[model samples]
Target: MAALFADPLHDQFGTWPVAYIPYGGADFGEIAAVAAEVGNGDDDAYHAAWIAAAERLEAEAETTLASGHESSARELYLRASVFYATSYHPLFGAPVDRRLLDAYRRQIAAFNRGLALGPHPVRPQRIPFESQAMPAYFMPAAGYETEVRPLIILNNGYDSTSIDMYFLSAVAASRRGYHSLLFEGPGQGEMLYEHGIPLRPDWEAVIGAVVDFALAHPLVDPSRIALSGTSLGGHLAPRAASVERRIAALIADPGTWSIADGFRHAFAAMFKLPPEAVADLGKLDESVMQRAEQAVRADRSMHWKVIQRGYWVHGVDNLRDYLASAELYALAGRAEQIRCPTLITQAENDPAAADAETFFAALRCPKTFMRFQANEGADGHCEMRNRSLFNRRAFDWLDEQFNVEMR
Candidate 1:
């Protein structure tokens, strides 16, 4: 499969918007135009190009709205929101770029405007957390708006926003007659960008609050609440489900057992040390740390991933500290605690899924492990390349698990 850009990082994140095409979050022509404007591996060029595209669509959306083309305006606004959300990935380091903040605000505004114009009643919510509130949106299944219905809580990973979940998961869930809740937790979206909250390992506390909100909602069926996490949420969701028994079913797209797995592998391969030697990244020797740091400095991708985004998300200033913080986010001793039926997915080429089998094997509850192959065109992380297929199979599994007949 040919990539959209010459730069690996650019191609990886740049094509993310295409995943939403089925639900009106983007168009291939619009995404191709932006890709044409960006230079290979050029972060600045990527940021500028996406921003320009988003602004253009936003203006068009406004014009369309003024002319009373509600559907056209709504689609334009939603697509603009996707572009705005796509614009800030390359600028993810701290002291946060003003451009990133501005883009995020624009994304949220456009998304809200688009949803506000849609036929469905989408409600924005603020789930109370410790001394703060987590921003959330509840989109009820059509025809079941006022009745009690099973709900799917969509949790995104390290780099995606709640708006992304709307296109990636919520829309699909809604179409299948399932109410969906899209939210941001600590170190995610609004919590990280606006509140300066770093990522935390104890997701049980974060999800507990979200479950509380779901239980209180008149339209939510408390007995069939499901939690599905994607990317890093793969790990975060499992961690939460381990303790939050209210989650009747759990799904981890390309299941992740530990955040430190990548770090461990990098250290092993970079330093020529045995895997066991780097098993605990938090306890690395100073000499090994110096060498690893220098190696990361020379690699642009690693520099951005480890030094920039990793440090910022973990609220750490150095690689060593980032590694240490990441160690806390593992489900090694907790998988057995999850009482609900779990579905763990693994895409053939998703590096983050290297530990999916191990994680799946550790679970004591009734579980299913799903694998996506390259031949299926669904092997990309979170199966973004073909999310509809993934969602169809996943929701079917959920329906069966909850004993609810498919609509």
Candidate 2:
């Protein structure tokens, strides 16, 4: 095992592996250093190191920007944004913590500044949702700001922020002439940070709202809009697609058919209880619930990455309640409702979900299941370790489906 608290199945150092992706927008050296310090579960140490990195880099960014070196300053500022973002542990009293608030502020300021210097035209805006607005970034393909191109809506995973959608896949989509809109819904990023909204199981409502925004926007091709969900978003996106037919195509990075699989596994492995019992939270013995919650709180790895964050986002204090709420995320009868062409990508080494093949088979729509093995160094969840390779394959599929250009 990588460590006692490593992802029970992936053997990754931590549940999130915040520093695992060395792609753009992050400092590899500093990430490496902070990652090492946190390997043993020193969250305070991790937060401190990353915050220090952000402050130092942001200071440097101001200096270079003053010297008229916008290019150098842009990259530095972006890295600072990433560092500042990494400093805030979502479970660490984030609801009202000034440190988290401050970090979020820096993250946005630096990201917007850096984004303006990018090759594509980007807008940080909000999408109208029910009685409120959802945070998002719209990146029109270079030179196609006013012209309608095929639109790709990107949804980030459980712990990932809205900005992560860009570096993860939006930029790659833009390079291939696709406009990308990256957004955060309940339980993710700013929604959880700014608004007190937690995650809900009916993601179709969240997605339908975005589709409304896309269809109303002048720069979106109503007939060719696709949705790409990363990590936990694999479930969210698919859930949305199950009912939201406006989505022309769908991509589930590391296809996850059910969120219950995670809770089920954790319950069985850690507590030696039947995972299905989680369905009936009210029936669970209070003593059993206490023990399970205690186990989660005791394990530093589970505390922040899974249980604590789950509690905060799901608005539950106990693990049983959290798992009970997750039961709705399953696509039991809904998979057949997805009428759009769908692609489900899987990492050979991922533990995000089991029986993804069954989920793929369940889809009655035009579907493709693509698998990445360990040899390519792309076997981690969402292929984060080598997203370029994964994106190449995914976008190639998109290009063929949409009849777009290739390199």
TM-score of each predicted structure versus truth: 0.97, 0.89
Model 2 C-alpha lDDT versus the unseen true structure? 0.76
lDDT tens digits, residue span 201-256, model 2 = 89999999999888888889888999998988888899999989889999998788
lDDT for position 173 in model 2: 80
Instruction: Give per-residue CA lDDT, model 1, range 174-230, as digits (tens).
Output: 888899999999999999999889989999999999999999998898999999999
Worst ten in a row by lDDT for model 2: 1-10
What TM-score would you give candidate 2 relative to the actual structure? 0.89
Q: Which number leads on lDDT? A: 1
Candidate 2 error regions (>4 Å): 1-23, 33-41, 90-95, 118-121, 265-282
Most accurate candidate by TM-score: 1
